[model samples]
Target: MRTIHTTSEEETCEAGKIIAAELRVGDVVLIDGPLGAGKTAFVRGLAEGLGADPRNVSSPTFTILQQYRGSMPLYHADLYRLAPAEVADLGLEETGLDGILAVEWPDRWTARPTVAYLVVIDDQGGDDRRIRIRR
Candidate 1:
């Protein structure tokens, strides 16, 4: 387990970049946070770190899953709206193969991935966040 503190969004995203640099294919990153807690911002840095176009990374609130190509392909999943069974229907196992997966709102699912990095965002005072990472 590891932890990081950030006073602003940029710092949070930068931290994500650092973490992203350590990622490999088949890596699963599960992000847990309340609304506006910088989950998406972290992923933006992750995309940038992976040599992907950061502009192409966006919240997949509607589509549920998005794919991006860079040094390695990235599979971004948002499970905020789906039920556990529905999430299973998407076949996470398949999507995670040959790519890196960054998932938001993974609470609905009961099963865990083979290797997953957990990011918990704790909101402190204004613009302050405590980001904890565990694998």
Candidate 2:
């Protein structure tokens, strides 16, 4: 487990890029944070680090899932607007089989991968944030 602190969105993104270096295909990352905790910003960094266009990354809250082709692939999911029971229909684990999976609002996912990295972000007011990564 590791903890990182950031005072701006850019720093938060950098933290995500740092974590991306340690990821591999078939890996799941569960991200838990408040609505404005910079979860999407962190994912943008992930996309950039993985050779994808960061500008193409966006919150998938309405779309449910978005796939990006990077050095490998990135399957990003947001369950913010979905009911917990609806999560299974997406088959997230299989969707991310060929790449890394990053899920926001993962607590709504009852069948989330047991072996996965957990990222918790706490908003410390203004642009500051405290991010904790656990395996």
Candidate 3:
């Protein structure tokens, strides 16, 4: 497990970029955090580190899933609005088979990957955040 403290959104994103170096194709990252916890910022860094344009990354809360072209591929999903039963219909397992999958509000995902990186973000008031990552 690894823990990082960030006092700004940029720092949180940098942490994500640092962790991105350790990821590979077919990797699943489950991200859990409260509202406005900089989850999207972290994922923006992930996209940038994986060779994608960070400007193109955004929260998929309404769209559900967003795909980006990178060195491999980035399939970002936001399961906030879905019930656990609805998650399977998205075919996330298949979508993640060829790229790195990052899922926000992953508690709704019932078919979680057997092996995955779990990222938890805790808001510490103001712009401070504590991010914990583990496999």
TM-scores for every candidate against the unseen true structure:
0.94, 0.97, 0.96
- Any residue pairs clashing in model 1, and if so which? none
Task: Please provide, for model 3 over 1-135, each residue's C-alpha lDDT reduced to its tens digit, 9 standing for 90 to 100.
Answer: 999999998998898899889998899999999988988899998998899999988876479999989888998998988999899899898987788999999899888885899999999999889999998
Look at candidate 3 and give me any clashing residue pairs. none
State the C-alpha lDDT per candidate.
Answer: 0.86, 0.90, 0.90
lDDT of 1 by residue, 1-135 (tens): 899999998898898899998998889999999988989888887888898998888787579998888899988888889999998898887786897889888787667574699999888979999999988
What is the Å distance of residue 35 in model 1 from its true position? Answer: 1.3
Candidate 2 residue 31 Cα shift, in angstroms, is 0.5
Q: What's the lDDT of the predicted structure labeled candidate 2?
A: 0.90
Q: Model 2: residues >4 Å from true position, as ranges?
A: none
- For residues 1-135, write the lDDT of model 2, one tens digit per residue: 899999998998899899889999888989999998989988988888888888988986468899888998988898999888899788875888888899999998999987999999999988789999999
Q: Kindly indicate the candidate among 1 and 2 with the higher lDDT.
A: 2
What count of clashes does model 2 give? 0
What is the alpha-carbon RMSD of candidate 2 to the true structure? Answer: 0.9
Q: Residue 84 error for model 1, in Å?
A: 0.9
